[model samples]
Target: MSESVLKTLVIYTATLVIAVALASVLILIPAYVHYGEIHIPGSYNALYLSKYSPYKTIVVEIDYQPGMEPTPKTIEALQQQIEMYSGKEVLVYLDQDIEDDEVPAVIYGYDIIKITSMLQEQNRDYRTGWFGGNITLYILYLDTIWQQEDQDYSNRMHAASTKPYSVGVTYAADSIIIFKGSLPQNDMETTILLHELGHVWGFGHTNESSNIMNAEFEVYRNGPSPDDVVETWYPKDFSPAQKEELARLHETMHILALFN
Candidate 1:
C-alpha cells in the first residue's frame, strides 16, 4: 500500500477510537447533587408550630393488637387533644395490628423504643415527607404490660415502689405504648391516652391531684372516690398549669427535620 494512503487510514482509525472513548465517558458521567438533612429530635418537635421544621403536616398512626382497639370516644378525644394543643391540622390513621399473641407479654423500658421502631417500620404507611412536609405520632395498643427496666436490686425496688404496671408509657418523643391490659375498658382508656399524649407534648407528670397528667393512675381509677371515672365531677382534660405551659408553644419556635 502507498505510504500516504496507509498514513491517512491510520489517522482516521485513531480519530474514530478517540470519538468512541469520548462518547463513552460522556455517557457514564454522573450528575451530582449535594444537600444537608434535618433530623428534628423526635420527642417534642411534633408540637412546635414553626416554619423551620420540614414537617408542615402532622400525621398520627395507631397500631393495635387484637382486642386492644381504642373506642370511638377515645379516638375522638385524642384528635381533639392534638388539635387543641398543636393548633395544626391533624390526621389520625388506624394501622395494621400486631397479633394479640404476638405482642410481648411484658416490654422493658430500655427495649420499648427499639420495639417501637421495629413495629413502626412494619406498620407505618405515612412517613415523614410522604404526603409533603409531614411528621408522625405513632401509638401502639397492645394487650401487654410494661415493666421499667430494673437492672439491679435498687433499681428494681425503686421501679416497683414508684411505677405501677404502666397503663401507658411514652418510649420516644413521638411514640406511645398503651398497655391495654392495664386499662379498665371505660373512660379510663380515653384518660390514659391523653395522659401519655401529654408526655409527647413535652409535659412532665404533675402533682396536682385533679389533673390528668398526674404520674399515678390510682387518683383517677374507678374507685369509690368521686374523681374516679373522670367524667363525673371535673372535665376530662389537662390541668390549668399544663394548658399554660402548652400555651407558650405558639411563640416557642424551634424547628427541625425528619427523614425524607
Candidate 2:
C-alpha cells in the first residue's frame, strides 16, 4: 500500500475507534442512570426541589392493578413524605385502572413505561407541565414483580429469607414502580414507596443504616436484627440530616409562596 494511503487508513481507524467509544458512553451512561446505578448530580432538583418552581403543587397520581393498591395508611405516609420533600401541597389521586390479567408475570422498567404513556394521558388529574397546573408524579402498583434487566436478584439472602429483594424502583425522574406482590404488608410497602420517592427528589444512597436514603433495603428489607444478618442497614425513615435539609427547603418554599 502507498505510504500516504496507509497514513490515511490509520487516521480513519483512529477516528472510528473514538466514535465507537463516544457512542458507547452516550448509551451506557443513560442506561446506568435510568437503572439507578449511576447518580447524576442534581438530576431532579429543579422539578422536585428548588425554592422556585413555577408552582408549589405536586400531585401523586398512582395507577394500580385491580388487586394491588396502596393502602390508606401508605397513601397518607407517602403524601406526607413528598410534601416534606417538595415543601409544597401534595394531592393524592389513585386510579384503579390497571388490570392484573393484563400484566406480565415478570417485567422490566421499560415494559411498564410503555403502558404509562396511555395511563398518563388518561389520568384525570395528570399535569406535569410547568405552568397553570400542578406537577404530576406517576407511580405504578402491580400485583406482579418487576425484574430489573441487570439485577440478578432472583436468589439472595434477604433479611427475611432467601427470596428476591426488589420491592420498588424509580426508573425515571417522575416515575416509580412498586412490587406490590413482594411486599408482605403495609409497613414495607410504605417504606419502599418513601424510599423511591426519595430517589425522585435527588437523594442518593448513603451508608447510614438509619437513614431513609440508605440502599441496603435494595438487597434486603428490614427484619429483626440478627447477629448474622447479611445486610446490616435498617432504615426506619428519613434521617435527621435529610429531614433538616428538607425542612429548611420546605420552610423556604412556604415563605416564598407567601410573597407570591
Q: Against the unseen true structure, what C-alpha lDDT does each candidate score?
A: 0.63, 0.65
How do the residues 1-260 of candidate 2 rate in per-residue lDDT, one tens digit apiece? 99999999999999999998987567643343343312232344444555566657887789898878888988988887777667678888888987766667766546656655555556435746534466667788877655445345533233343444467887666777787876654556677888888777657788866667777666553442334335443455787777776656544433212211
TM-score of each: 0.67, 0.65
Per-residue error at 168 for model 1, in Å?
Answer: 0.3
lDDT, candidate 1, 7-101, per-residue tens: 99999999999998886445321110001111112344433344343455678889888778888888999888777766777888885568655
Q: What is the TM-score of candidate 2?
A: 0.65
Tell me which residue pairs clash in candidate 2: none
Q: Which candidate wins on TM-score?
A: 1
RMSD of each candidate relative to the true structure? 12.2, 11.3
Pick out the ten consecutive residues of candidate 1 with the lowest summed lDDT: 30-39
| Quality of model 2 by C-alpha lDDT | 0.65
